[model samples]
Each structure stands twice: as C-alpha cells, then as structure tokens.
Target: MPSITINGRPAEFEEGQSILEVALAQEQEIPHYCWHPGLSVVANCRICLAEIWAPNPRNEGKLEPMPKLMPTCQTMAQDGQVVYTDSPKAVANQRSVMELLLINHPVDCPVCDQAGECYLQDYAYRYGRASSRFEEEKIKQPKKDIGEHVLLYGDRCIMCTRCVRFTREVTGTEELMVQGRGATEEIDVFPGKGLDNELSGNVVDLCPVGALLDKDFLFAQRVWFMTKTPSIDGITASGDNISVEHNNGTVFRLKPRPNASINKWWISDEIRYGWKFIHDESRHVMPMLRSRDEWPSPKAAEAWTASMEAATKGLKSDGRLAMMVSPMLSCEDAWHLGQMALSIDPQAVIGVGPVPFNGEDKSFPGGYTVRAEKAPNARGVRRVLSALGIDVLDAVGMEKALSSNTSIDRVILTGNYPSEWVTPSFADAVGQERFLLLIDTLPNSLTSRADVFLPGATWMEKAGTFENVDGILQSFEQAIEPVDYCKSEAQIAMDLQSALSGQKPTVFNAAATRQAMASQAALDRFVSDVTLPKVPQTVESDMSIIEL
Candidate 1:
C-alpha cells in the first residue's frame, strides 16, 4: 500500500485512489461540494483545494512543492506524497471560494428545507469570512418545478454540475443540462423532456445545497428534528439500504444508505416515495371478532382475547387448518406463524401468499435496478417454510387448494401488502363455510369476511430479515412503534401459540427467534448469512458549555 501524509496525519492508500477519497476514508475534513464517490469527478468545487508536495527523483529523494494548489478530488495519490489542506495558502483559497459561492446565495437558512444537513451551510460556517465584499445586487432566480418530484431553485445552485452529470452519465436520459454562461448559468430540462426519469428524485439527494428539493417533502419537516432509522427497502425486491427519517411517529422521508454491493448511492423514486402507505388512514388499527350474528365490534383492545379465542374455537389435530403467509411478512414473522399453524394441526397446509408484480425489471446505466416484484420477502417466506420441512405452495397453488380442498375447514391468512390485494376469486375460494382468521395491515374484502381479524404491523414497524430475489438475507430495525392498536405479525403469532397451548405468552425478539431458527440443521445459516444494516455512531463533542 502507498503511504501519504495529509495534514500531519499519516495514512495508507491503495493505488489510483484520490486525495479526497483517502481523506474521507481516514475521516479527515476536506470541504467539498462537487465530489461524490458514485459520480464522476468534475472537480468544479474549488473548496477542496490543497497544497501538494512530492519526493523528487532527481534531487536525491528531496521533497518538492508544486507551483499551485490542486483539487484533491481530481488528484490521484502517489507514494510518499505529502498534502496540506489547512495551510495558509489553502485556507485563503477556501475562504475565497466560500465568499464567491455565497455572493448570489439567498439568506434563506431559516426557511430552507436543507438547513441542518446542507454542505453549503457547513462550509460557509467553517471557511467563510465575517462579512461580504461584494456591494452589487445579488442575483435572484425564480424557483422552477422541473419534474413530478423535483424542484429547482436556480439562485442557490453553485454550478457543481452534479445533477447534470447524473442525468447524462447515470440515468443516460440527458434530461438535465447547463444553460447560459458563467455567473448566469443555470440547470434546465431539454426542450421536449422534463426531469421525469424513474430516478429523478435522486437529484434532490445529490444536491449539496438547497438548489434542488423534493417536491413531496418540500416543507414537511426540519432535518434536525427527525430521527433516522436504518432500514431496507420494503416495497421492492431490490433490497436497497435506506434511512427512515421520522418525527412524532410520522415518517417524513426515505433516503438511500450507501451499500456498495446493493444500491450504491441512489434509490429509485418509487422506493423513495413509496413509504406514504405506512401512515395512510386506511390502515387497520384494531383487532375485531365477528359475533355469532356476524357483527364486528368497533372498539380495539390491548389484549385481543376474544379474537384469539374465536380463531382457535374449533382448531384441532384433524389437519383441517391451512395457512397463507404473505410475501410482505418478515422471515421471522412467517416462521412464527408457520410454527403456530403446525402446532394446531400437524398436517396443516402452509403456503406463501400472493406476490405482486408489475412489468419487467428496469436497469439503469449507473448499475441501479428497479425490480418488477413489488413484494420484499417472498423468497424469505419460501426459505423459512422450506427449512421447516414443509413443501410450500405458490400463490396460485394456495388459491387452488383453498377452492378445492374441502377437508380444510379453518384458514389462517396473513396480509401486510401496502395496497388492496384481495380479489373476488380468492375471496370466493375461502368461502363463508370455513373459519377465517386474518392478520392484515389494510382493509379489503377479506377483512369484512374474516371470522376473526387482527390488525398487523408493517415492515417499518417490525424488526426482522427479508430475502431478496437474489437469495440475499438483509435485516432491518424497527423504525417506529406500530400504529395505534396494531401489533407485529410475529407478536400476533406468538400470542396465538400461547393461547392454543395454554402457556404464558412470551415477548417476541427478532434476534432470539433467528437464533432459534439457526438451531435447526437446515437453517443454521440464518445466524451467519443475514446482513444487518450498519448502525451509525454518535460522536460527543468535548467542548462544555458555560452559563453566562
């Protein structure tokens, strides 16, 4: 490995790595706006300029200084290279760049959406001077609604060209371009096209300043007040890592977490905006049990004893129970539900629920993908069932069994799909004759027909693993508590198990359940193969406050 000294700190680097990349790896501060690891390096942001010194071959290996400062982003690291980013010359250049960038920038920090997380705000505080030198009027540009999900504020843009490069090099749509010259330059859409690509929302994330903003989250909440939870994409099988940012139990936005193997630095607009269903008013918030006369109670309960008792009224070892596990469930949820069904009747029919698909998989030039399969855990459900020594049936097979299997008189169905997933044929298959126990997150025809219905939690409200289409197991943490009166499917399954066995109910723990699954010979991989998202650490400052 080649070694370099950056600002008195020595670090090792691999060949072809740039000074900015190495500095970032070492956790050193190098103020930058235009450089992103996933995008091409244009080095237009002069804030990362650093003085360089290299060993001279002709002068008996003596250190030789370069004539001028270099852009750390574009300069590759060399062996025995010395870089100074905090020297007087470098600091002067940084102050100058910050001063220039702020000349036309509006003083909208109090009203800007990116106030706390804006790189411009951070650099301005660190590198800017006390007052402005310019006496002329600041240029003011109007905000433009560029696309369905993105808004462009021309005056705030420092012309880093990140958005322009993303459209041309990543999506290959070429919808965004730089218009006009020098100080008056601005980003604009093509004549007949808008920034309406499937990945257009990413421009908002790529913007280092408030120039680009998400239309859906424009004035929703301040960044500093929200808590970000590491989570995986639940709407698709792409398994893109993401951060669920929320405040007061309300999710404000979903931003991509960098995963080199999965979604690198960008997530599709569908995944970014697909979390609205989690807080929709139509979600089920109470457990209900139909009376003998077929009327359901309107109130919810902390202990759903009546619903559990109704679900297990006639369940016996007669092998008359069939379970349909939805693809929207986590692997731990599916496993617990499956074990409970088998405990009631050893020969119970366990099958995976309906998996939704739309069109074909769409691939982008930047290596990001949009999957056709809308469900997140179909593969995980199938894997758990297979490990339990059960031959799982597909969605069609389960529907057919429900229609033809006259012997099955009790059914346990779990549905956590984001939208309405019930069909007339499927409803008719599980006819009114049999006992239907449904655990679901949303209202549909089945909720009305179920003999006992329990409100279930969404993926965001639960902690568990999901297997993607590629058979990769990824785990996510619970972002927020379950919506009022709603419980996780895993907890519902455990409660039913306790009710049937006349034992005390145990609290469901995702990690402990996974360890129990790993105890089985076929599922031992669950302990080792599941990929957990990295938890960010909070660094406390050493500075103490004094009362004035």
Candidate 2:
C-alpha cells in the first residue's frame, strides 16, 4: 500500500491504484462524468485535474511540485506523494473547463433533467470563476434525437461519452457513438439505428450534463421539490437500493444507490420508471374497512383488530391460520410479520404469494441482468416462511387454498400490487364464513371484502430491509410521514400482536428486525464485495459536486 496525502490527510492505496480510487474510498468525493466502475476508463473530460508534488529528479532528493495539472483518473498513486486538490491553480483549471463546456451550451437549466445534480451546475457555483474570458460566436448544434428513449442536445453536451460507452460496453448495443473531433464532436445513433435497449434509461443517469435526457423524466418535477427516500424496487432481483424521490407523496423518479454486491451503479429500467404506478391515483391510499365501513382512527383500528383477534384468539392448529406474504414487502417487515403470525398460531399456514417472472435473465457486456423475478423480496419472504416450518404455496396454490373451505380458519393477505393480485371470486369465495384480514399499502377490490382492513405504510414512510432477486438484503430509511391512516406494515402487524398479546406495538425498532435479517441465509449474503462507483479523476483540482 502507498500512503499518500490527499486533501491534507493520510490516504493509503494498494500499489498501482489510481488517485481517484483512493480519494473516493476515503469518502472524499470528486465529480467526473466519464468514469463508471463497470466500464473502461475514458479520461476525455479534463474536469478532474489536481496539483501534485513529487521527488525532483534534477535535484535528486527534494520534492518538486508540478506547475501544470495531471488527470487524477489516469495517475497512479505513489508513496510519500503530496497532492493538493484545493490549490488556486486546480480551481482555476476546473473553472476553465466549465467555461469551455458552457461556451456552446444553451441556457436550459429550468427545463433540463440534470439541472439540480448536474456537474456543470454544481462546479460552476463552487469552483467556477465569476466571468468567462471568451466573447466569440458560440458553436451551435441542432438538438438531435439519439435513440427511441433518449433526446440528445449536442450544444449542451460537455463531450462526456458516458452514453457512448454505455452502449459499447454495458448494453453491448453500440447504438450511440461520437462523431467528429475536438470542438465539433457530438453523440448520435448510428446511420439508421436508435437507442432502443431495455436498459437505455441508464444513459440519462450516466450523463453528467443535460446532453442525454429521458423523455419520460424530462421536466416532470423540480429536483428540489422531491424528497429522497431510501426504498426497495420489487421489479427484479438485482435487489437494487433505490432513492425514491417524491413530492406531495407522489413519486417522480427512481435511481440506483451504490450497492456493490448487487447493482453497481445502474438499476434496470424496470425499476427506474416503475414508480409511475405510485402516481396513478388509482393506488388505494388510506384504510378502507369492509364494504359500507368507514375509515378508522389509530384507536379505532386497534379496537377492530382486538375484536377480530378475539374471535380467533385460540387458533387450534398451526396450519389453520394462514398469512399471505407478498413479494414486494421488505425483509424486515416480512420477518416481524412472520414472527407475529407464528406466535399467535404456532401451526400457522404461511404462504408466499406470487413471484412474477418476466422471462429469462439476460446479460450484456456489463453485469448480467437477473430479470426472471419481478418481485424484489421473494427470496427473503420464502426463507422467512420456511424458517417458521411453513410451506410456502405458490401463487396458484395460495389462491386455491384460500378458495377452499377447510384450508384455513383465519386468513391474512398482505400485498402492495398496483392492481389486484387476488381475483374477486377467490377473495369473495374464501372468507364468506371465516374472518379475513387484508394488509396492504394500496387499496383494491380484494381489500373491500376483508373484515379487518389494516392500512400498510408505503415505501416512503417505512424503514426496513428488502432482499432483491440476488438474495442481497439491503436496508432503507424512512423518507416521509405516513399518508392518511397508514402505519408501517411492521408496526401494524406488531399492533395486531399488541392487541392479541397485550404488548406495546406503537414503538417499532427497525434495528431489531434488521439484525434478525442479517442472520438469515438470504440476508447474510449481502456481506460480499464492496466498490465505489464514482470518483474524481483529476489531479491539480479541488473541485467537487456541491452537496445540495
């Protein structure tokens, strides 16, 4: 390991490691658009320049600092090396790059998708000079449609080839490429081709500037208005940690949080745009009691559950009472729910419902896409169900058992499906004579038939762990207050337990469930490899993306 001075602090790196790697590993952030961990290093963007002082060969013994800067991404770390990123020269260089990058860029901050988090916007505020030296006819290029999913404005581009590299190296589509040289270079689709890959949405995230924009996410909402909530995406197994940014309880965009073992930096488009369902007001928000029933308060909710649990308080057989576990649920929520169910009815029939599979798990030049499973936490739910010595019936068997008369004495259905996962006939036919409980985030026709309607907290207000398709259990933090009468699924289930067993369920300790999940087989797998997806690669630079 080479111990070097970074930002006036000691930072050590393995021999031959780049300065960028060491800087980012130390939790010191540097912003650059062209360097993604999964792709080959392309140091075309000179925005990451930093100053360095090394041993002078002419003097033979003394340290000699370079007047000109070097690219931190391409420069390997050396022992006893002294680097200054916040020096005057480094800041000036960054400003110059921003000025050059902005020369031909149109003023579209109000309408561009990358406005708030864009590198240019951030660097200009922090390291950018007050005024530009250039006063010439600026180069202008017509905004072109690069692909089916992406709109390209060449004039606004900083010549960051993130889109081009993503096509060539990640999706292996090679749909986007750069044409011309120097100041005239621009990104575009090949002769007759357009970017139509399933994962094309990722390019928009890759672009540090507004050059590549998603038509779906374009001008949808201002970034400042959206509060980011750490949540899980149940679309696929690439159990990606997600930042659910929303406004007024409505989700606007989703992006991958850097989880090394699972998704590196990019989440599949399935997850990126999946939040649209949350915006479709058809989502059942607030608790809806059985038909012709009114919404209940926290106190009223407990009373109803008390009466319902009192009826079946003495569950005869373990398998007589069934709890329907939804795949979209977080692992922590599922674990606690399973514990509550088992404690009430030791012979509880635990059924894991529905693991929706799109088709095959496909791969490109980048890491393979685990696409078979649509639900994120199926693995975690199944493992938790099996841990309780219960048989997890498939979706068909679950529906069949609920439909049959002798299958269960009391049944609990937990789901967050955008639409009804269980059919009306099955829901209506199941609990005509028996008591039925529905635990859900959104309301559905199936919920209307439930005797005990417990409002489940959406992903925004819940802090729990979820295991993705890769069996990687990731934890997320709560973002906002629970909408209407909804409480976290964990707390609601705990409240039901409190009603039956007289234990206080109002205080939910997510840490306890998180620790429990950490021991399980499926969740234990998250302790694998770790990596930094983005870092500064410029030496002689003190510029960083400002924390907004």
TM-score of each: 0.97, 0.82
Query: Highest lDDT among the candidates is held by which one?
Result: 1
Can you tell me which runs of candidate 1 are displaced by over 4 Å? 292-299, 314-319, 539-548
Per-candidate local distance difference test = 0.89, 0.72
Which residue pairs clash in candidate 1?
A: none
> Which candidate's TM-score is highest?
1
Model 2, total clashes = 20
Error of 2 at 477 (Å): 1.7
